[model samples]
Target: MSEIGATPDPGEIKDKIKAGSDRANALKAYVDTVSIKHVHRQDIEMIDLVVKTYELLTEIMKLVESKVDEIGNAKK
Candidate 1:
């Protein structure tokens, strides 16, 4: 939420990005640990799907960071 007509802050946006990345990483780790402990024949596909999804999210976050840097440089 922003005050009306308030300009967005890149620093704040970067902080948010960092936080999201951290959470994604934490979830990925937890999933990996849990899967290792409890993987089953019927659940393998679901686990793989979840792990791949997190991998995609991580890659997307990296791309977002790159784009932010690219845009900021262009603005300068």
Candidate 2:
């Protein structure tokens, strides 16, 4: 029998990744829905920064997903 509290299964890791990606996508959608014009000029720069950060985060998630795929393939 397998030992208890062993290394996590790849499937579990993938599930966590999917959950995180889903949340990130939801946050991105929320950010995209905010009207730029509604933001005061003084805070516009901050808003722009936030949007860029979110874009970068989305890219990072894609990279992570690719890595996960690589791991799965390696095990096959």
Q: What are the lDDT figures for the candidates, one per model?
A: 0.77, 0.76
Q: Which lDDT tens digits does candidate 1 get at residues 1-76? A: 4467875566776888899888888877877777355668657777788789888988887888888787778778
> Pick by TM-score: which candidate is best?
1
Structural similarity to truth (TM-score) of each candidate: 0.73, 0.68
lDDT for 42 in candidate 1 is: 58
Candidate whose lDDT is highest: 1
Q: At residue 65, what lDDT does model 2 achieve?
A: 76
Residue runs of model 2 more than 4 Å from their true location after superposition: 1-7
RMSD of 2: 3.6
In model 2, state the lDDT of residue 6. Answer: 73
